[model samples]
Target: MEVDHLFEIGDKIVYPMHGAGVIKAIEEKEIQGKTQQYFIMVFPVRKLQLMLPIAKMDDSGMRLVLNMTAIEKVMDMFRQGEIDRSLTYKQRYKINTDKMKTGKTQDGAEVIRDLMLVKKEKALNSNEKMMLREAMQFLISELELSNSMTEMQAADLLNDRLNVEKDAG
Candidate 1:
């Protein structure tokens, strides 16, 4: 969907690098002697605001939150531990970074899933650990809000799914 059609004030969106943010407003501004439109997003938890030029929204990879169907698919992948988990750290980092840069919710889900798996197997390096924590918190917050559940409940659901998968594998 086009960014303009997909986004509006009060809409919740996921920015790849920034996680979940709400659309605070859309406004016109004068930049470089031209009038331009921009989407203003507020990251409440982080206490930061991001402004993206409307003309560059798509290229910037701004995206809406996952729908119920997509959320379910992500949960299914988590439950089945479907992602390959044996890649080198550098390879894994590159892959997950690419996924995030694409602004695809499912890709974010995969990164969360894989990182959780890695965490289960062994301790992650500092950078990996930090990224995993950020991804998990982002996924949980968005899922909880979208699914109408508490964050703890959402996390419990993920843990239960991971436990089941660990048992099966």
Candidate 2:
């Protein structure tokens, strides 16, 4: 049975942790003798495919791509922020991980912003380094779809104004 859904084919959306992708199909497959509808999405840049069960979509932390205006606000967030050095690294990582799981562009930008600030002071541990890398890729992926930017263009945008010094000399 074909039914209309909130998202349709060709719609672009962000799947938390996997980045942005275009919905290619809504398919029903029989698994464990049960048939269920799934959204099949393709991440162009990464050449990755993901299947999201319709019943579980809301719980998956997936979201539609941000519009240009909201994306601009996210960029602003990346440009403004101070790290809380008081917390231990584990606590910080837990908070950042929670932010990433929100599937909100603003939270991802905040994670990136806080980590970049930490980087300016000292090196990030292996886990922090990996978190930073994943967050960066996710940001760039969403930015590309939001503004119709090439991956390179999106990356360049992220780098711009990122070298700000908190204290003016």
Candidate 3:
């Protein structure tokens, strides 16, 4: 399969479950006598470099970072009310994890928004707390890139916006 090489070096992209990164290089290597293309991505959040095979990129849920307009739309999602909290934690976990796997900004916002509501109500189990932390960090990192703001600035803005909604509710 000839995969689309849509990403260029220096392009910022998001790898689901891994957060956002920049494409540092594209390389082809032969393994088992088969040559394949790979995108070398540098994730600032984890300070890690990964080689993602181009052919599998689409299936991996890798995507470009949200543009400013799309970021604004995601911010709007935060202003909306929380999702249904009737489900047990296990059920909620599955739904939220599926949203995270989509690598879509709005879906990510949903995960963050729902989890934030849960945190407000009571203590989250360790798993839920870790998920909240990861989701928040991912949102902050993407906001930094899309808004051209520093990490601290992005984080503060995110909290301020969410807090406003929290206070209103």
lDDT tens digits by residue: candidate 2, 1-169: 8676689998889998888889999999988898999999999778899888898987898788988788877677655667887999999999999998887888888888898889889999999999998888888898898889999998887776354433320
lDDT value for model 1: 0.76
Strongest candidate by TM-score: 2
Off by over 4 Å in 2: 2-4, 164-169
lDDT per residue for candidate 1 within 1-169, as digits (tens), equals 2344568899888787777778999988898898888899987545689888888876877777776667777767775555466688999899888876776667777887788778787888998887777777667666765666776887887777667776776
What TM-score does prediction 1 earn? 0.80
In order of TM-score, best first, we have 2, 3, 1
Give the distance in Å from residue 6's predicted Cα in candidate 2 to where it truly belongs.
0.9
Model 3 misplaced stretches (Cα beyond 4 Å): 1-4
lDDT of 3 by residue, 1-169 (tens): 4657789899999888878889999888787898999999998877889998888886898889988778877877776776576899899999988988888777888888888888888898998888888888888888887777888998898899898878877
User: Could you tell which candidate, 1 or 2, scores higher by TM-score?
Assistant: 2
lDDT of each: 0.76, 0.84, 0.84
Worst 10 residues of 3 by lDDT: 76-85
TM per prediction:
0.80, 0.92, 0.91
